[model samples]
Target: MKANQPMVKVISSGKYAPSTLITNEDLERLVDTSDEWIVTRTGIKTRHRAVDETTSDMAYKAAMEAINRVNYDKDKIDLIIMATITGDQMTPATANFVQAKLGLNHEVMSFDINAACTGFVYALETAASLLQTGRFRAALVIGGEQLTKIVDYTDRNTCVLFGDGAGAMILEPSTHERNQAFFFNAARGDTNNTLTVVNHIKMDGKRVYLFAIDAMEQAIRKVLESSGLAIEDIDVIIPHQANERIIQSVSKSMGIPMDKFMLNLSEYGNTSAASIPITIAEYYDQNEVKNKKILLVAFGGGFTWGSAILQL
Candidate 1:
């Protein structure tokens, strides 16, 4: 980051997954895939379903969790950026619904970003940039998805790979230099429609797998280079919970240890944009990450990929 730019600090994070869960066994009855196959391939045992909850509902709950963590002043939050392809509706952005749910009946700048699984990182970078302008105070950055609503249960290829959940982070511009943030978010056009959602989710598994490994590795390297930090300088890495194989591949190719990556996909599957933030929330719950240098990386549909390095 430039010296003239404002710094942003992440105050808190929270995540929410609905009560309904679809296990691998449940999928076995619905499709031809079995428990062992699903587990061995995706490293996902079960994925949560929204049931009656909408995308905005999960987003609101997640934002509330972060707000209540420090009893943050809701009125101070003037910006809300949500990431979700499975929104409640198309007219009003999902972030608007989240703002209403927060009871912030004020002039808040709110919107949504559809960068697929890389949505959270994109939203975070956008929020930080806006905050750096000194135009916004506290901001809510959320990644929520109801992918189950769009997933085709009959298609074994994509049916076992998604879930519904939301994760939120509260950020504010900081004067402390230690609170600086660095990010890289970009995408490659997908003319082939390798991974897409049109009424229902569809994907070419082999193509996506190949793209994911390369995209994630590049993003990680770019962000680390931008920050002039080596992999050892990062206390932990939170990667998009897309597939275990992709992450393992990046780790091996980069020579980074598996333990350095914070992973929880075994329980949540791929929550699209919600994966990274949800894993971050869970990791914070289990570990002391004070003053830690954390790296976040992701790749998704749109052939989008990016990374961020944050001091927390």
Candidate 2:
């Protein structure tokens, strides 16, 4: 290697969950739902519960796991980006606490990003821009959502769709000719003041289904068009785990097969911003993504949607 190469490459990725494994059947006890009902509609079988774990603890655990996977000096970590709709506090940004908890006290800059379920993709876009500008060599981007905190367990329509967990990734620029410099984009719909109920996530399942399919199709097209790659060129698609129907519909509309898209929503449900990173991590564990062109598309509550095309 030379004196100083541009930061490139995902050093490692990590994920963590609570001790409790709450299955859809367990949800039947708490709400008017059945395992079959959930499985048929959303393809969710179970999700992790925090079990007294705070968002801070979960975020730190995921960060440590990512750091452990790589040998980079902690001092070189210049940025920490955290994506969460449910930050530990409504005042202090969760990234500050993460930076402090991880002993990242080199006067590094950090902040929280919120695009509801699209948070991780948004944060990753930010981290990638920092990399391109040479403003930061190594960045820690985490998507940790304690969605159970905000979920209305009494509402069967929404409650069964969420879980608690954290997923992390280490990113650095690259000079090597690998799967790099693909497509990156984000688009948003106007925030629905009428649809919102005083700062809470207002989700109408049917409405979201329509929105997810539409927004996802647009984002996917942008990634393909911006990168000048055909839809057939992508090897795997790591889309946000909003629901099974949405994933399938998008795949079909794009003229792609279902097997080309990764599935982890059945296990983790929807962890808001954590969905994308967690899905990617699960795919990594399976060793299905290597030297492959991947398209990551996401849509979330903010009505925010994004996509990133990578070859890795």
Computed on alpha carbons, the lDDT of every model, listed in order, comes to 0.92, 0.80
Best by lDDT: 1
Model 2 lDDT tens row, 1-312: 222222357777778888787899888999998999999999999999898788878988887877775655777888899998888987688888888888877867788998877788888878877887867878889999888877777878888888999998888877675636454456556455312324344577777788889988998888787777787888888888879988888878878899989889888898888887877767677784557777888887657888887656
Clashes by residue pair, model 2:
7-172, 7-173, 7-174, 8-172, 8-173, 8-174, 291-312
CA RMSD of each candidate after superposition: 1.1, 3.5
lDDT, candidate 1, 102-162, per-residue tens:
9999899999999999999999999998998888888999999999989999999899999
Q: Which 10 successive residues of model 1 have the least lDDT summed?
A: 1-10
TM-score: model 2 vs. ground truth: 0.91
* Model 2, residue 273: C-alpha shift (Å): 0.6
RMSD of 2: 3.5
Residue pairs clashing in model 1 are none
Q: What TM-score does structure 1 among the candidates reach?
A: 0.98
Error of 2 at 70 (Å): 3.0
